[model samples]
Target: MYETFYGLNGKPFSLSPDPNFYFASRGHQRVLSYLRYGIHQGEGFVVVTGEIGAGKTTLIKTLVNELSGDTDFVIGQIASTQLEASDLAESVALAFGVSNEGLSRSQIFNRLQGYLTQRRLEGKRALLIVDEAQNMPYSTLEELRMLTNHQVGDRQMLQACLVGQGELRARLQEKRMEQLRQRAVAFCHLGPMSQEETQGYIKHRLQRVGWKGRPELHQDALDSIYSETQGIPRRINTLADRIFLVAYLEEKEMVDRDLVTEVARELAEEQPSASDESEAALAGTQKMVSGQGEELMEQRLSAVEERMGSLEKLMDCRSLAKALIQSLQRT
Candidate 1:
């Protein structure tokens, strides 16, 4: 909605990963270099792990884009779920466009091996990229390692890249994963951007989408954003997106610290933290209990008032009857 007002060609801070918006931050650049080096080696696993929304997928996408024109590489990618060993093989086959309909586990493996072999004969190296690989069980990961064992002569017919969250690294360090670890040509962990990188990232994305500084981001505002999001690319995108929207709504050209702070506060309220949710829940429960107590007290007070009124009426009637008796006796 704010794109036109901000004189932008598209959404700069979109949540979706796009290669066009890839910023070569220090950490991202190092990971990219590692990936390129691993791919050049062309025969083993290249493992990349990061926190959620740490741009691991985007880095891979960027590398793929750079390699799109190369005819020597046949790349297949899949985002893994919690898959069993056989399911993992099937998923790998399907990712490379090999049909697995009605096929048994061995049959699927044979087909995948044949596909990789065919690619090798065609003078192209097949690369399998498994994203979210941390979801796979140990058996499934072992299956992945076994897939790398497919050989055509001395050269292996396939290479694999495992991309997942930090837990994948931890899991790979276990004793059972020694075989897979031995075959890893490259392993890299992507960390969050530094504060300076965070500022550059926001400006880089904005510039990519034709931002000419109409909605100027002040330094204090940038600082506030970094403080709010802590240099995570995804979080920065989210908060910056909201900040721009707020600026557009308020018809302001310059975004200062106060505006960013206000927007951040609003976002915090909208998406409460775990602690915030717990506190709110407790407060709500207490309010309900207090309300019930007040209602019970009101009911008791009404009952007491009714009883007092009845007693007053009874006493007045008795007095009137006594006065009548006295008059009669005097007569």
Candidate 2:
């Protein structure tokens, strides 16, 4: 919505994992390298773990695009979330181009195994990439493990890459699944970007979409971003995207500390302070809400008048919190 005001070609901080807007921070590069190593070597069970929105999907999308037409390999990706074993078989069968009409469970399994074996015998490797794997049920996971039994005499029929938030690690360590855990040939945990990489991450994304003007972020602003987001790209982007609009609409090229703070307060998913109101405080909060986004109520923050402490200051912290909650929910 604020792109033209900022004079940009497109939105710089969209949530979609578009490859054209991808920026490989140091952590990303290392993860990509490991993924390359895993796929090329036909690692049996590759694992990529990261915090939410740390760009795991972006890396996987890029890898899939790069490997799409390769004659030596075939790649398929599935997003698993609370699906049963039969549903998972459907997902797998769909990825392998099998029609599901009137197909029995055993028939579907036979078709997948047959396809994997054919690829293995033809000197081609098969790759299955599962996203949000933490949501997968133990039954479905066991079904997945069963697929590993397909073989061309000795070589395995396919390799699998499981990508999910951190919980997947614990899920894999279950006592009943200890045998499957041993099959992992590669595993890496993706963390947030480093402080310096945080700065580069912003610039890299901006430049990808034809950003030619000087970056409007001050050094201090970037430092605050790094600190507030703790180098998490998704949090950084959330703060940055909102500030982009505020600065653009105000015709200010540079984003500053105040803008970042307001954006942070307005974009955070949780009200961390929602329930801190007495009857009097709640009444004052309702009044403060009507005056928010126009004025910051600095007059109430004189330290002399702020006897109610920092929470209410007539600043409408609740409104800011409410705005963020609503915005994210709409998304």
Candidate 3:
């Protein structure tokens, strides 16, 4: 919505992991290097872990884009969602475009091996990228390790990259995961961008979408955004998108610290924490009780006023009657 107002070609802060908007932050660059090294080796596994929204997907997408022209590599990607051991083999097969319909577990494995062998014979290496791999069970990971056993002499027919959250690192450290760990050729943890990197990241994305500085971002505003989002790329994108929308709505050309802070507070209020929700509920209950008490007090006061009014009218009638009787006697 704000793209036209900001004189941009597209949404700069979109949450979708587009390779065009990939910013080479320090951590991302390191992990990307590791991925390149793994691909060059063409054997074993490459493991990458990071916090949610830490740009792991973006890094992988960037790598894929760079290798798009290479005919030697065949990449297949899948996002794991708590897949069991038996289901994982079939999922891998499907990801690589191998039909495993009506196939048993062993049949699926055989089909996958045949597919990898074919690719090897064609002089092209097959790479399987498992995203959100922290959701995969230990048994599933062992299956992946077993797939690496399909080798032609010293060269393995397949390589795997496991991308997931930080928990994947912990899982790999467990005693049961020693075999998989041994197969990992490169491993790296992608961390959040530094504050300076965060600034560069925003500007980089903005420039990518044809931003010519019409809607200028003040340094103070950038700092405020970093403070609010803690240098996480995804968080920054969410806040920055909202900030631009607010600026466009207000018809402002410059985004200042006050504006960033106001937008951040609004975003926080929209998604309150559990403790905040509880406190708000308690305050609402107290207000309702207080309002009820005030209503009851007003009703009692009205009743007392009506009774007093009736008594005053009765007293006035008695006085007038007494006065008439005295006047008649005197007459």
Q: What lDDT does the true structure give each of the candidates?
A: 0.92, 0.81, 0.92
TM-score pick, better of 2 and 3: 3
How much lDDT does candidate 1 score?
Answer: 0.92
TM-score of 3: 0.82
Q: Rank the candidates by TM-score, best first.
A: 1, 3, 2
Per-residue lDDT of model 3, residues 89-157, tens digit only: 788899889998898989998898899888898899999999999999888899788877789766798
Worst 10 residues of 3 by lDDT: 146-155
Identify the superior model by lDDT, candidate 2 or candidate 3.
Answer: 3
Tens digits of per-residue lDDT for model 1 on 1-331?
8999989999999999999999999999999999999998989899999999899989999999888789999889998888888687788888889999998988988898888888888888888999999998999899888878878988898899999999999999999999999999999999999889999999999999899998988999888888988888899888899989989999999999999999988988887689988999999999999999999999999999999999999999999999999999999
**What are the runs in model 3 whose C-alpha is more than 4 Å off?**
276-331
| lDDT (10s digit) by residue, model 2, range 213-302 | 644678888888888898887887887887787776777777777777777777765444555547668889877886783356566466
Q: Kindly report which residue stretches of model 2 are placed more than 4 angstroms away from their true locations once superposed.
A: 269-331
Judged by TM-score relative to the true structure, which candidate is superior, 1 or 2? 1
- Model 1 ranges off by over 4 Å: 276-331
Candidate 2 lowest-lDDT run of ten: 268-277
